[model samples]
Target: MTGIRAALARRWPTIVIFMLLGPVLFMLFDMAFEQMSQDPGLTLARLGNWIAEDVFFVPRFVFMLGALPAAVVGALVAWRDSRGLASGRWIGGLSAGFGIVIGIFFARNLFIFTPPPLGAQLAIGARAFVSVVLAGFLCYGLSRPFARPLLSQEER
Candidate 1:
């Protein structure tokens, strides 16, 4: 639709930033997961082996290789979007909304596998609700500074 395209046109930089950094963020998270996947003793053994094999380079490799491009691209997007208040607000709010939506999807996945302890489930659901609300509020707050100033400038 024209509306969707127009909106994207206005916030393309933010979208691209999200796209570019998303993978790096994902890989960062993946590294954490990878570490978790290894048992402590096993991890030590592997570390020893890496050193013995001269591959102590493994973990550092991922960090060094993956982090820069992602960070740079993300920074570029953030800088571009930071140009003006109006577009910045729009971009920030939408990004927050998207994050909350994604959080909901993750919550749904968790709900199905969640233990059925009645009170616990209630607590989890409440926590999820609170998290979503907080995420939305965070987005709104971040946008407010940009939006308010932009609107005031327009009025003048």
Candidate 2:
């Protein structure tokens, strides 16, 4: 238990960043899934209508009002986490964060008969993997200027 505590003590910031950024990352992921699928439109429309319907869109008001603000905040969080190499908290936080989302969707289905299609499940899973790559590149790009110089193998 103390081992877990000690690890958490050292990694809390990483974990918290993941917790904060995971959902926004997932939302950003919707665009990728749509690009890959037959219906090449924002999947956010399908999910976000429950929140707000007439906020903003390229052609129409598809994305909800909160989306702009959410995007801004998400960007900030991503930038905040954009230092150093990926940490163990990245994996742990992704699993834990998505677990909560899955739990919420599961509970929602208990009350409502409608369930999201299998594509949505595939998207969620794919997003988990894709997010790592996307976030890693973002971190790499953001940290490049501040990163220390690398050396040849002999230097190590």
Candidate 3:
């Protein structure tokens, strides 16, 4: 318990920033999913319903969209804290990739109701997991070239 508390105390700023950014991330996910879907109108309507009808849904959605990705970014930031700006850019890209993956899973589950087909569920999970990981790697690869360190040489 003490260990967990200590970690939280050390990392509270990052956690809080992520939590605050949750809504923005959720909106980005919503927009991305909206664009991807065949019917944008229907997507907007469903999103509206979720926001208006269920208070709990938004928080969960935000958590999945925001907190999960933020956690990944935060972990990377902590891991690569002393690293340079290149690392920062990679972190951003990685974070975005993760956010998108988590968003896709949450969005699919939100809209699609799969029947009790164990195999189907397994397949979907596997596919989604693989795709998300691939996307993350892609993001990392693309962003690494552009990344700049977060701190200056003097700081290091």
Candidate 4:
């Protein structure tokens, strides 16, 4: 208990930041995917309606249960990336979100409706995990060239 309190006392700011950041990150991921799914090209104007629609939907409400944790993981990725490199957080968050989506997809395929062969689940899990790793690296690489130039001199 003392240890917990001490940790919290030292880390409360981080805790609070994450509590605020998590929902915003989740909403951004949700909006980006929803927008892309709705149209392959730009649809910025439609976002207002989509956000309003999203909040009222029951399925989305249920999915938020899963997404919040995933978004927090994304937030962690973003936070880590921010520490090391500028502009990495955007793509890092996207990659991490994609990783979470891959995980959810695998779970649904392997266990949600019907159990698959043990070998199949193992194979899929290995592939999905590798994909997640590669995606992060790829996104990080993509962001590297863009990071420095995008920042102001003060930020750099």
Assess each prediction's global lDDT (C-alpha) against the native: 0.43, 0.43, 0.48, 0.48
What lDDT tens digits, residue by residue, belong to model 2 across residues 1-156? 565454344434434443344445444554445444656555556646623442434212212432443344333333343434443455345445544554444334322456567766555555544544454344334433323323542286
Instruction: Give the Å error, residue 90, model 1.
Output: 14
lDDT digits (tens) for residues 21-60 of candidate 1: 4443433343333344456633546545544564344445
The C-alpha local distance difference test score for the whole of candidate 3 amounts to 0.48
Preferred candidate (TM-score higher): 1 or 3: 3
User: Compared with the true structure, what per-residue lDDT tens digits does model 4 show for residues 83-122?
Assistant: 4534445555565666666655654563546767777665
Clash totals in order: 0, 0, 6, 0
Worst 10 residues of 3 by lDDT: 141-150
lDDT of 4: 0.48
Error of 1 at 14 (Å): 7.8
> Candidate 4, TM-score vs. the true structure?
0.40
Residue pairs that clash (backbone atoms under 3 angstroms), model 1:
none
Question: Model 3 over residues 1-156: C-alpha lDDT tens digits?
Answer: 565454444444444444455444445444444445445544656766655676556556554655565555544543343233235456556645665566456545654455436554454444444444444444344334223343553387
Model 4, residue 110: displacement in angstroms? 14
Using Cα atoms with residue i matched to residue i, what is each candidate's TM-score against the true structure? 0.33, 0.33, 0.41, 0.40
Q: What is candidate 2's CA lDDT for residue 149?
A: 27
